[model samples]
Target: MDKPTISKNPTKKVASADHKNLSSIAQYLKDAQGSHKRSIPPLDQWQPKHCGTIDLKVLANGEWWHEGQLIKRQAMIDLFATVLWKEDDTFYLKTPVEQIEIEVEDEPLFVNQVDQIDIEGKTYLQLKSTTQDLIIVDAEHPIFMRPFKDELRPYVHVRFGINAVIQRAAFLHLVEMGELSENAQGETVLSLKSGDLDLHLGT
Candidate 1:
């Protein structure tokens, strides 16, 4: 199934904050974002000081929570996502002034939608996250299975050491679009291709 592309607007203001603690962080991000001309921030150029940790967490299911309260506004989440930065194994919400550590249960993002697009004569799989990040299934953005709980779950590289968990529905979609075949080791594997990039869905 084809999903709509990510929005190009970068000037959307964050939604009104319901939690006082989150409001402070949200305000800092908003102010730091002064005029967001770029769709994604230039996180590489930003080297802000560490501002300690916050009560923010991204749950395994891709829901964002702050101070034990679920963050329900998509605008707020999108705003926060623009500043998402990964250093080593820790995830942080970064700004021009400072960076604050946040906990991520699994991957920091989730692929909620998948689209199969025929570009010219080649078939390509496009994955979209809840925060409007689009990742093409290719060598640079390969999908691999990771152990979660007792089962293996699919994940894909997003950008700069950040990965997105493939939601079950999206994983099933990829399975339906994949080709079943035997690998070199005689093990059955479902293979998917995007242009010249080939990947085994789940072996």
Candidate 2:
């Protein structure tokens, strides 16, 4: 199989000719964070023009790449992850002023760590992504089983309509925390509970 590659010299043009390169975009994103508190831009309100495609891509293994080069810095990855947006079925790196399309081989994120915590008297599952994005398993961020290759795999909702495929180890941990029982149809079901939210892992 041939490996995907992008030009080392990426020169994609955008509506704003002044902001022509990824470096400017990166700087803008960094500057946008005026305070220490971490938060995403109100992308819902901003109607930035669609900037042309970029060489950035998120591989199936949850690795980020730019111009065919692997992005090894976690801080850079986390910064880019914050701007990931999905429209219809395509994924893009969105900014307050512009958006650029990017390739995603599979799910854009991965949940590699999970912990069980008790809030008051209710139990909750806390999931951490590779980028350090924390998500709580509940009514909004639910887990579902999806077919991957020949086997069923677990996936959880992250944010902004994006989701993460639960890693094997974390999936095993969830199974250990779940309760197995026969459902109304007499099918074996594995379930987990968090606060008032009850979820079925699989059957």
Candidate 3:
């Protein structure tokens, strides 16, 4: 498949249009420093604030770019992922003091690794994201697939209202683990069950 074309100026241009919000978030991030070991911040309690958007974007392949430049620091991406928050229709990287809107080409996160574990006849799928977050496929983190022309793209809920797109490698692994089964109307389908949730891949 051809690589998706990207425009790096869009995000920064948006932020430039609204200097108030843009500067606020940028200043907060520049000054804020601490270990990101804690869980996701309590975003629901944060009152709506207008922090301008950033040039930061989460690409389709799970790459984070800033100002049209690739953010090569995995540590930086992981740190930013911890603070991802969504309010209404906007996605943000929020800290206690400020919040900055970010552009996401697809889902906010990308699942790059997957492992299957079987115990006592039950199978569990463990997914690892680009940010190194571990997510288990269960009722809480159900999988959904959307069609992209002839290809179907899969996504899974990561946390705090953020969803991670399952990349090609991990998706193929899931397909390898899929088992053929007959669904409710006796229609044969390829399905995979993790925890208590059963997902239909395809025929």
Q: Give the TM-score of candidate 2.
A: 0.85
Give the Cα lDDT of each candidate. Answer: 0.79, 0.80, 0.72
Candidate 3, 1-203: lDDT as tens digits: 54333344544534454443434444454455444353455666666555666667777767777766677867667767777887676688777755667877767888989998775678889899878888888888987877755776888887777888888888888878887777788875668889677888643
Cα RMSD (Å) between model 1 and the true structure? Answer: 9.2
Across 155-202, the per-residue lDDT of candidate 1 in tens digits comes to 999987899999989888888888888877888788888878988755
TM-score ranking from best candidate downward: 2, 1, 3
**What's the true lDDT of residue 63 in model 2?**
84
Off by over 4 Å in 3: 1-33, 36-38, 118-122, 148-150, 180-188
Looking at candidate 3, the ten consecutive residues that score lowest on lDDT are: 17-26
Could you give the C-alpha RMSD of every candidate to the true structure, in order shown?
9.2, 3.7, 4.9
Could you give candidate 2's per-residue lDDT for residues 93-162 as a string of tens digits?
A: 8988788878887788899998988888888999998878889888899999888777777899987888
Q: Each model's TM-score, in the order given?
A: 0.82, 0.85, 0.75
Local error of candidate 1 at 96, Å? 1.1
What is the TM-score (0 to 1) of candidate 3?
0.75
Candidate of highest TM-score: 2
Off by over 4 Å in 2: 6-21, 181-188
Model 2 residue 199 CA deviation (Å) reads 1.7
